[model samples]
Target: MVNKILCATRNGIGGEIVQVQANFVRALPAFVITGLANSSIQESKQRIQSALHHIGFHFPALKIAINLAPADLAKSGSHFDLPIALLIALHKKGIDTQEWFAFGELALDGTLTYNDNIYPLLLEIALRHQNAKVILPTSGQELFCHLPHLQIYYASSLQEALQILESPESTPAKTQTTLNFDTIHIGDTDYYYEREFPLDFIEVKGQEIAKRAALIAASGFHNILYEGSPGCGKSMIAKRLRYILPPMSLEEMIESVKLQALSAQKPSYTPLRPFRSPHQSASKSSILGSATQNEAKPGEIALAHQGILFFDELPHFGKEVLESLREPLENNELVVSRVHSKISYPTAFLFVGAQNPCPCGNLLSPSKECRCTPKDISSYKSRLSEPFLDRIDLFVQMQENEQDPKPSLDSATMQQMVFHAFSAQKQRGQSRLNGKLSEREVEEICILDDATQRILLQARERFNLSHRAIQKLKKLSRTIADLDNAKDIAKSHFLEALSYRYIS
Candidate 1:
């Protein structure tokens, strides 16, 4: 007897359908699996046999052979355990089975264990088969409640799963009501409320110019570089910027949740934007992304999709790793090309970098004397290449004070202003925020006066700005103008935008 079951496999955040074919015949008693399975998958034979005995089910004494079809693509992970077990049961019992998708991990005691990478499987199945039944572990039941129009069977043990499979009529079908998997609303809870930003512009006591620059960076989703002495609040202000940014939309939230699900992180359907701060010692593969023998996994950038990717102590990162971000930063997606497969992962994120003026950290201090030579400072700055700096839009310098002042504006007030500005930009036919606008859209929306244009041209000549940098400046100026509710870019906006240019 031969039985086939449908299972799902994920390849670099994308999903593929796998067919598990099992055959039982009157031959020498043995178990075999084929179709380029990895070690973990090959080990499923022992797990299945042990789980069957623990569940008080008898294993078939006849020759048993299981093959995962589409034999060319390599299959990995222990997720195939449940499907393999079901096929074995069908072969042993002579039960007719062919219509469901099964995925789960089995414990030694036959209890079902939660498996990672269920979201991609669910999404792929939803796209292919509309009325397919998915048998998942009961432990992960909550994760699927948001998905609608699919039949879900929550099984706690192997015996329970066998029972559900054997008696099709007894299984209760999932509800047909449409459910939005995005936008988790929390009423009267801390999860719903944005966190209070401890560091505010007024509290800085100085550097009003830097404060204005921060506002523009936040409004436009522009990458910012803050260079100053050690005691300055460069890091402090960068951390607080998220509190004042506009909330995420339903589409952004769903995309983020999908990435989180792929990374095996908890998916929260909340409005809070993601913030990723990786250490400088992180590897290129970990930061960018790497391919396994079978599938590719998302790295830090993908995890921070639609949010902030802050690199504190920027110069401390490896030059190669930092340079790898040039493509993803420009294209909003990272393409990991392996010999066997080419996988692209979405990595649209806001880049925020901070660093000291020099190795001594006192090169730009007003009161403190500089100890590092000009050679030393140049060497330190060169660690961040011009190509990387060209991608950054806003650069500001922070100043430290002996006494921090009282708060000027709280997160709520700042959030309101950001929200209003965002609304105005959207109303102007610029659907996305300033940071994500294309060249044509930027030119369409960021119209400047003659005086502002002259100033930008002069600054472009003096700073030797690249075409990309000039466009970035225009976008930043547009964000500043939008925040002030101005119809066009004024002299003030142009000056502020120019000040952010890296001065050698």
Candidate 2:
């Protein structure tokens, strides 16, 4: 009988199950793996060869052929080693690996292990093939403990695996992951921070208006831009915004985990929202993803889904890269079209950008003299086109020593306002945050009185705001009203929303 066992391979955001088919023929002894396996998978031959031998498996001279089925798609990862080894060693034992899938990397000595990189692919299996039985490394059993329906068996070594496969009916299922949406926190409670924010709003020394703008941005999930001289607390405020933003749902936590797992960085699986601050030097391909004929890779924007993407020294970035932010900023999702396939990735994130008013970093400083010429400042400002600037929901101009001697707002305090606003929106049955309201939803939630509507029209004409600008303004007003616990968008809220629209 032909021995068959299934394993996983990443296919875009999802995965594919590859069947390891082993055929032992009576011929000259040789081991071969076919079907476009990568060098890592190819290198697994010696490891698996030694492992089966070390586990006391020695056979008469025969040709051992292993082919990863569905040969059209290329496969990688050493996790393929275990299933292939199992198929080769257990064909005579008549063990039915067809009942479940297996995944793990093998050492020459027969130990089994995997990494967080496999977590997402494993999750894809859980999502697509619900109630599927899977045998994964015991090392990551905790990763799946909370997931129900799917049964898992953890094996740490080749010997341990043999014992389990020998008595399949008696082996118990392993622990799975359980996602808790209710264990949410604003800053320091139930959730975890990858690193403690060393600076607080209380330590910022000044710029209370900028802090208020930050609070509104956090409460509404609004895109914000900051123009100030260097060291003007712009970066400091952006850093603290994630912790103070609305609490995440269980779905968001899982999405965050998947995004990080797909990237080069390791997944933290924390409830804390992501805060991705890519430097100005990052490439367009790095900010937006890149795709080949067979694969698509996520960029900084996709990686920042359900969280924050901060650009410091925004003007210094490439014009193409800066303009590329338009798609995600406008539609909240990116549609990447290539020759063979079109793929979509979530780009829902709060885009926070900070730049000096001028290249010399002193144009807006009251204490320091302006060294940049008018033309120089104009060119520097031109880096951010009008279209791009119009997309920003909140724009704050920070002045030197507009700074207070002491800080007043803290993250906990801001989080309280954000949480209150969040509760207000939810109480009103709003499905999305204020910043993400659709045009129809904006009309539904943003209730402006006659006077407030007149002021909005007047401000729209005065500022020459586009329809999108008006919609964003309404959302901002709605957010301000929510923070104030007011039902209607008051005149003060409308004017306050308009005040932050201009760079001045």
Candidate 3:
């Protein structure tokens, strides 16, 4: 008799279902597994046999052949152990297997174990197969607690799992609580907005212009650059921008959690967007992604999807790493290619770069005298090319110090403005923020007044702006208009957008 069970395996940040088919025939006592499995999967037989032995069940004398279906696809992970063991044990008893999905690693002493990586696979199963049931380890149930309308059966050991399957009707499956998206709080608590952030905007003693630019950048998801002397709060402004940005939608939250779980970290269900700040010494492969012997993994860019990628000390990063971001910044995704494979990952992040004006950090400071030579300054600035600079939406020069240090903004006040701009984008049916809008979408949504159009034309001609730069200006203008709660782009908004263009 042939017994079959459903299983799943990870593929990047997603999951693919596998059919575990077991056949028993009269022959010499032996067992084998086939179908493009990796070393970890091939080693499952030993684990399964040990677990079965501990459960008081000996392997049958007949030859057994287990095959994972879809022979062309690569399958890895120890989660296949449970399904394979279940199929073989039930085949020996002449018990037919149903369509329930099973995933867990079997211990030598018969205990089933799982980790946070199971959450991505679980999410994949829940989304693709709505009516499917699951048999998972009991310890890792928290990952699926918020998922609704799914029937999950939790088992602690191989013996307990078999007993539950034998008398399936007696063991009721655990049901997920219904998540009301419309009514559910986005953050963990109602006081989330009022709580003090670790790096609040109020902490910055001066640089009101920089804070206003930060607010605009957060409101529209714009890529911004801050050039100033040391201790000018450049990094401080970039670090706190993520908190003021709008909350994520339910679907976006699920995607973010799934991506995080791929790294084997316990995923949390919070609407706050991710804020990734990789060290300046990170390698190109670490930021863009690379293929291992068996699988390709997402890099820092993918991890920062739909979030913030703050590059402090921009010139300190490798030239290759800094330039590689150009494609993802334009396309909202990245494709990493290796010798035999290519993997694509979403990288829709708000790019915030902060850097010193020169190596001595006093080229632009009025109070500090620059001791570096002209060639030295040129070399330091040459690390960032003009093409890369053109991608930045806002370029703000922070003040050396506050002549009048009265803070004009705080996190709470700026977040309210961000919410208004976010609502405007949603009202216009835009999935992305204003700064990431396509050229065609900008033309469609940002209706410019005659005076505003005339000013833009003059600026494009006078500045020798590239076609891309013109499009970016229009997007910036649209964001400025959104912040002002205006339906159309006005002359003042166009002027504010033009003032941010990079001069060098």
Residues forming the 10-long window of minimal summed lDDT in candidate 2: 186-195
Q: Report the CA-based lDDT of candidate 3 relative to the real structure.
A: 0.81
For candidate 2, write residues 19-82 as lDDT tens digits. 8888899999998899889898999999998989898988648888889989988888888988
Where is the poorest 10-residue window by lDDT in model 3? Answer: 186-195
For candidate 3, write residues 1-504 as lDDT tens digits. 678888877665577888899998899999988999989899998999999888788777889999998887789998898999998778657666657788899999989998665777888888888867778898776666655455788889888778767884845466544333223242332112223466788887778778888888887888999998998888888888877887666567778888887755568776678888999999998888776545767788998998899889999999999899999998898988777666789888999999998999988888789989999999999999898998999999887876455646788788888877877787787877888888888889877888888887888788889888888888888888889999888888889988888877
CA lDDT of each prediction against the hidden true structure: 0.77, 0.81, 0.81
Kindly list the per-residue Cα lDDT of model 1 for residues 12-92, writing each as its tens digit: 677888999998877999999999898988998889999988867776578888999889888877888999998886665
Model 1 stretches with alpha carbons more than 4 Å out: 54-56, 92-99, 127-131, 166-208, 261-270, 402-406, 425-431, 447-455, 486-492
TM-score of each: 0.86, 0.91, 0.91
Q: Candidate 2 regions off by >4 Å?
A: 147-149, 170-197, 337-342, 405-407, 427-431
Evaluated at residue 76, the lDDT of candidate 3 is 91
